[model samples]
Target chain A: MIQTLEQISTIAEMRVHIKEARRQGKTIGMVPTMGYLHEGHLSLARAAKENCDVVVMSIFVNPLQFGPNEDFERYPRDIERDRELARSAGVDFLFTPEVSEMYPKPMLTNVSVSHVTELLCGKSRPGHFDGVATVVTKLFQIVQPDYAFFGQKDAQQVAVVSQMVADLSMPVQIVPCPIVREADGLAMSSRNVYLTPEEREEALVLSRSLKQAEAWLYEGVALRDIQERMIAMISEMPLAAIEYVEVLRYPDLVPVEQPTPGESIIVALAVRFGKTRLIDNLITSI
Target chain B: MIQTLEQISTIAEMRVHIKEARRQGKTIGMVPTMGYLHEGHLSLARAAKENCDVVVMSIFVNPLQFGPNEDFERYPRDIERDRELARSAGVDFLFTPEVSEMYPKPMLTNVSVSHVTELLCGKSRPGHFDGVATVVTKLFQIVQPDYAFFGQKDAQQVAVVSQMVADLSMPVQIVPCPIVREADGLAMSSRNVYLTPEEREEALVLSRSLKQAEAWLYEGVALRDIQERMIAMISEMPLAAIEYVEVLRYPDLVPVEQPTPGESIIVALAVRFGKTRLIDNLITSI
Candidate 1:
């Protein structure tokens, strides 16, 4: 029988519930998120559910991942609404841990992956990947899922997380899912709620710039030219401040010096509109 | 039915065997060691056997934890003897992966615990705890055991590892076993095999010095006096070279400036005899 969506707030309860599921020979799939659910997050949930018998989603607004000046205090959170949305999406378990529960005392341990963390979004938001890596380490241990799903919108995150899992010999398979965007082309994000209508219109430029880069790649333009064109297109929008623009090799995140006749590379960008930072990217074989 | 000890040298094979054990509703206990059969290692295996339905001992001589100057190449290894001893001690599965298997590529991930790593052994061995923390993290993931056993002989190691597990919220219970010593009171270590017969006799000073501190504590000696007297005793042994002698509080390695009437503190010491460096410690209530 399919059970009702179960809410677990403590580590002990989550472990017990997961063990019971495992005993029944059920495969666990986890979707870790920060609680203000959107279609993108739901897509990750659906991907996990499709791949495994049980779906466990973590709803934690991790304080460690937020910078001192960032919106940690004001980050969106609505558990009642989130719970309803998670159930409607067929989530079997929702793990929502308090900050105190996640960090009873200050965390003294850090999990860091080198090289990839030194570029792009990492340059703008220092220590962000470290926080993400550490919390994800904790979540992986807490759930012990057979598979964990991540959205492709955060290209750097997928790369860094893949490095951690490989280096640590973690047994779970990290499956990357397609990014679910709005009908208009803007990427889905919890921070999207922070955007005003004008800000939202400007946010569309983040994806549009990537679309332009894709066209340039198809035309066999120089890698440098592609990067410059993408930057200029975003620069044309007064509200969008380009944090970084790079046409890079896939998986490794190394900058491609020149586009080869036919080579797979990731074109990634991060832009800020006022205080809200948005990131978007797509992979293409040029 | 009790099974004969099964040995695996690959991560894939070990995971499959462990999962099969878990499916039978057996709790797993892991004892990680470098290859060398000794009474100390056997004690860890016995402790795991007593508490768990299945005991897995991983014998990987992690090159990452050894400094270039330290004993990575010359570290004692006797897998045949280790296998025989492990079986007699009730280890059900022995995971002995190659160095290549553990690190097929240069590792890019590091798991480190701060504060606790700054004192005691960490001072002498730069990047040693980071190496230890990283490999232990890998071992824990590879085995995913219910309990991971450690010997209390390495007090600082126990403290640092406990910090990593707590900070990362790892699910395994870290079971610290009593320090198994030789009939003459020397702590058991694979490096003990490196001691020349004459140097082995001289190495007894490491434990003797700590025992001297215990007597001084009973005599109501001040902490400074106890430290000085222990140092003096080890210094008297011409072959024993004192690396460090610290009387510090438990959990945190803070120096106990003075001996209170009834406080527990760790009396840890490290000494070198020729090329072999040995360490030992005792915790006592004063």
Candidate 2:
């Protein structure tokens, strides 16, 4: 049976829970998410359970991480439903803190990684990574988990957090799990629920283009040629407005001219289906 | 008998000792200091012992915090003598990580606080506060203590760290102890060792003027009058080259015109005692 943490508002309450887990010699793993329990999030929870003795899942729809026009208000949250899913996924502790509970005052500090942060999602939303870095740092302090799991679907986010942890020498291991996808190869996202049937079909183009790019790389196609083909494929979808289709170095997420053998490569794209923006990525090692 | 943690060459080794203390349900307190420990450093350690179950003293003369032309190489270090003093002063762990251990690679990330960082020592040493903020952030992550102690001697450093912790929402409580002074009233600093016998005697002028300013404030003297008198006294000392003298808010260290009741006032001055620059402050509440 999984335990639900009731109003663990302060850092003190979180510490109490963490201390009890430590007393029992439990290795705690944390999966921090914005609450819309998609399979992608559940996959992270499952990975956490496999890696540690106890799994603490934090559901926080961080307003700071969302831009003014972004879907913060409409970001789907079903705590009761998510709780059941998390429990079934082997999460030992479910921590759901309110917005005011997490940020009592206006936040003044911002953590930013140079160079890498200027690409991908960062380009579309300014100050977004700063918000992500600040909130993640607060979460890390509150949870103090032995291992923190992040879905590789947020490929750029993984790169940013990795750079932050390494740069700050934070005392926790960051585990990036593989992205979970649907039967037709569309990456699982909580926003998928917002998709109309037509938008859902258009969203398929995101993964389809990524798959095409991956196959091209396997056949030793030029990096530029694959990128051009992905752009052409994404542009053809009537409902899809392509934000970016990029092939970059893994972990660092830097644009590479050619794929180096044994080096990880990431083919990532962002597409808007009507007003709803969705992101997906496929990482491979050549 | 006090348990001394000697021969900690790496940050990992130092973390192990602190983590073990935390595991035993003991609250850890840290007093971060450069080597050549004096009464001021001891006062912070004593305060830590009073409030926490374990006291860890870090003795790293952080080079990043010093300007290139400043005394990085010639900065005083008497580890053997400091170790004997730390052992006698009830310190549980003495963390003395080497330069290579602290900065293994070229540091790119720096923490900065807006507005408050632009005054006093920050104005004198360009990029000094950024360096201080970076090293302190690193120390906070490494120590992960319940409380970290700092002396009032470095008033600006205290203010900077406080702002950094508050802005970042760092988990540790910052415990600022009063500045410990010599019998003759000069503030204790490792750099005091650099002062000549003639210059050391002249350094007393810093404390004398601050005391005079405090007395004037008690007698309802105007803030401007107090500043003028203090500047005059410092100028009278042959070995003292006046840097800057001002009356400011306590802790925030911002320059203030008139003392606000219950808002503590700080009379601070910096003077070059021959080649060694020294700073001292006196706090008073209106």
TM-scores for every candidate against the unseen true structure: 0.97, 0.92
Candidate 2, residues B43-122: lDDT per residue as tens digits?
Answer: 88888888999888899988888898899899999999998888777787888988888888666456666566676777
| Candidate number with greatest TM-score | 1
**Candidate 2: C-alpha lDDT:** 0.83
lDDT accuracy of residue B265 in candidate 1: 87
CAPRI tier of model 2: medium
Model 2 misplaced stretches (Cα beyond 4 Å): A1-7, B2-5, B167-169, B237-243, B253-257, B273-275
DockQ of 1: 0.89
Model 2, position B44: C-alpha lDDT score: 83
Model 1: docking quality category = high
Top lDDT prediction, candidate number: 1
True contacts kept of 2: 0.40
Error of 2 at A99 (Å): 3.0
TM (B chain), model 1: 0.96
Per-residue lDDT over B155-261 for candidate 1, one digit per residue giving the tens place of the 0 to 100 score: 88889999999888798999998888999998998888888999999888888888888888788888788888888888887888888888888767888677575
TM-score, chain A, per candidate?
0.96, 0.96
Chain B TM-scores, listed for every candidate in order, come to 0.96, 0.96
